[model samples]
Target: MTVSSETRGLAVVTGASTGIGAATARELAGRGYHVLAGVRRDRDADAIRGPGLEPVILDITHPDHIEALAARVHEDSQGRPVRVLVNNAAVQANLPIEVFAIEEWRRMFEVNLFGQIAVTQALLPALIRSKGRVVNISSVGGRVAMATYGPYAATKFALEAVSDSLRRELAPFGVEVVVVQPGAVRTEMLGRAIAAAGDLPAMTSEQGQRYSGLVRAINNQAVSSTNAGLPAEAAAKVIARAVTARRPRTRYSVGREAALVHVVRFLPDRMLDRILAAALRPHSAVTT
Candidate 1:
C-alpha cells in the first residue's frame, strides 16, 4: 500500500541528480514525505522519479524555473504542506584566487549563493505558511577558506552568513533555518571540480609558478579526503534530522572533519595558517 503525503507532508530537494541531494530525496521519500526532487536534465528526472518521489526540472539560477517550482508547491493536488526545502544545488572549482576570472567567480556565486537565495525566496511563502524548515548545504570551506578554494569558499562563507541572518529572522515566525556543513564526501563533485579546473584558461607562467604546487596539493588532498569521507547517505541523514528534529540546531556538521573544522576555526589566524600549510606540505612537493 502506498502512503499519502497528506499525513507526512512534502519535501523539496534541489540538485537531486546526484550525490547528497539524490540521497536526501530518497531518504525523505523513504521516511514517508512526498518529495519533489529537482534536477536539470530529463535523464536525471527519469532516474529519480518513483513512488513518493517526483522529479522536477529546475535550474536554480533561472527565474522561470524558480517560479514554476513555487507554483508546483502551491498547486499540489494533495494540498500537502511543504515540510522542508533543501537548497542543495551548487558548483565547485579548485583554482587559485588569481586564476579565477571575474566571470568564473560570478558563475560560482550564481549557482552556489544567489541560486540558493532565489530558491529560498521563491519558496518562503509556502515554507512560512507550513512553518517549514530551510536546509542549506554549506561546507567546511565556509568556516576555513583553504588555499586554492577561494571562490567556492567565498560563496559558502556568504551562505553561512545568510543562514545566520535567516535563522534569526525566521525564529519568531515558527519557520526554521538550518545550515548543514559537510566536509569531504564521496561524490562526483570532486571529479567535476578537477575537470572544471582543467578547463580554465592556461595560467600565466608567473601565476603557474606561484600556484602550481599548491593547486596540485589541494587537488590531491581533496581526492584523498573524499576517498576516505562518509557516503552521501550520512549527509542525508543529518539533513533529515534537521528537518524533523523538534528543536533542531541552527547548524549541523555532517562529518567529523566538519566537526573539527568548527573547533579549528577558533585558533589564531597565523596558527591556523601554519596548520593548514603543514597539512598540505606532504602533497605540495613539486615534481620536475
Candidate 2:
C-alpha cells in the first residue's frame, strides 16, 4: 500500500452493503485505506460497521444519489484525492431469453451498465487527482455465456468492454482500470436467481410455456451450483490484491470455477457450445 503524502484520500466501494462489496470494503480498510461504503438503504449502511469505513446511501441507478456521492467524496477529501473506486454493484437475471421481461433487462442495465458509467464519471475528477485505480466487478459470464443468464451476461460483457476501453482512455491520467471476474461466488444473488426461476408466470401465459423447461433446469442447476461456489472472502482477497499491489494486473479471475471458465473461453466454439448445452440440459426426460 504505497501512497504519496498528498493523495491518500479514500477508496469508494459501491454495492457495499453485502457479499463481495462488503468483503471488499473490509479488505480495503484492512489495507489502510479509508473507505466510503455505498449502500442502498439506511439498514444496509448500518449493517456495514467496521474500522476505516464510512457508510453512504447511494442507489447507483438514481442520478441524485450519484451526484450526492460525488459531492460527499469531494467534501470529505477536502482537497485530498480519492485513491480507488470499486464499481461492484450489479444484478443477475436468470430467466430464459424466451421468457425474460424487457423491463428486467432494462433494470439490469440501469444499475450494471449505465449506473456504473454514471458513478465512474462522477468520481473521475477525484481519481485523476490521486492517480487512482478503478476496479470493476465483472463476471466469468462476461467471457462465457450460460443458459438462463443471457440478460445478466449481457451487462457483464458490456462492463468488460467498458473496462477495457477505460483502461486505455485513462492511462495518460495515471489512472488504472482493472476488471475482476469471479465465478459462482456464494452470495445472496444466487438465492434470488433460484427463487426467480421457480416462480414463473402461468404455463398458459405468453413466453411462459416456452420457458418452463428452461426455468426448471436453471433452478436445479442453481441449487447444485450454490454448493460449488467459492466463498466471498476468497474473491475479496483478489480485490485486495488489485487495490494494494504495486503493479496491479489489468484483470483478475478469482476462484477455481472462474479460472476454468476462462480456459473454456479459449476452447473451440463448437466444442464449448456442446459442453454448455449438455451441462444445461434437463435431467428428467420429456414424457410426452
Candidate 3:
C-alpha cells in the first residue's frame, strides 16, 4: 500500500466549482496529487486556479463532456494512472414526495446517481490501472428519511447502495470504493435548497393555509440547522482522507448530527415521525 510521491497520480473531483467539492479539490492538491477540478462552468475552473490544480469543464449529464474527459485523461496520464474519483455534484429541490415534479426529480437523479455512474464508467480504465480510490459523497439524508426532502434523499440512498455494490465488484480488481455521508455543512446549497422549497405551488386550499406556516417553519429550521452543521472545509478534509488513505473505510460519517440521524433511522418509523413532528412544530403553533 505504499504510494510514492511520484507515483501518486491525478485525482478527479466533480462539482469542484464550490462548496465541499472545491474544498476537497484543494485538500487533495495540497496532499501532492495533480487535481482535476470538474465543474459545469468555465468560470468554475477559474476558482481552482493554482499549482497542481487543473479546472476541467464537466457537466456530468453531458455525454460529450464525459467522453472528452476520458480522452484528455488518457493523453495527460500517458498511461500513468488516475488515482482517485470524487462524485460530488448534487442538487436538492425539496418538495413533499407526493407532489414532487417528475421532471425535477429526474434531474436530481441525473446528477446525483447517473452522473456519478457515467463519470465512474468513463474513468474506470484509468482507476483500475492504478488500483485507485472512488469516494461517493452521500449525505445524512441518504441514511434517514426526512419529510420535504425525499427526492434528494432517495438519490443519496441509491448512491450508498451503489457504492456498496461497486466496492465489492471493484475489490477483485484492486479499486477501493468509499461512501462519505456528511450531515449538513455550511455551503451555498443550503440557501438554494431553501429557496427551491419555498417556490413549490400550493397543493390544496387547506394545504395552502398549512403550507404558508409550514414553509416558514421549515425555512427557519433549515437556515438555523444548516448554519450549525460542520463547515464544508471540514467535510472536504474527510473527503481528502477517503481519497488518499492507504486503507480508506467503506463508509465515513461526518458531523455529530449526521451520526444522530443515523441513530434515528434505526428507531421505529412511528416514533421517529412523532419526534420529527414535535421537534419541527412551529413556535407560534405551540400557544397554550
Q: Which of the numbered candidates is closest to the native, going by highest lDDT?
A: 1
Candidate 1 lDDT, 1-288, residue by residue in tens? 445667889899999999999999998998889999999999999999998999999999999999999999999998898989999999999898899999999999999999999999999988999899999999999999988899999999999999999999999999999999999889899999999999989899999899888888888888878999999999999999998899999899977687667678579999988988998888776442
- Separately for all candidates shown, the number of backbone clashes (residues 3 or more apart, or on different chains) is 0, 0, 0
Against the true structure, whose TM-score is highest? 1
**TM-score to true structure, per model:** 0.97, 0.90, 0.91
* Predictions in order: lDDT: 0.91, 0.83, 0.83
Name the TM-score of candidate 3: 0.91
Off by over 4 Å in 3: 1-6, 77-79, 198-206, 282-288
lDDT of 3 by residue, 1-288 (tens): 434434677888999999999999888878877888898887777768787788899999999999988987899844556889999999887667766778888988999999999999999988998888899999988887667778999999999999999999999999999999898788999777867765766567766665556556666666667778888999999998888778888888888767665577478889888877776776335321
- Residue 42, candidate 3: how far off, in angstroms? 1.8
Query: How would you order the candidates by TM-score, starting with the best?
Result: 1, 3, 2
Superior by TM-score: candidate 1 or candidate 3: 1
Off by over 4 Å in 1: 1-4, 286-288
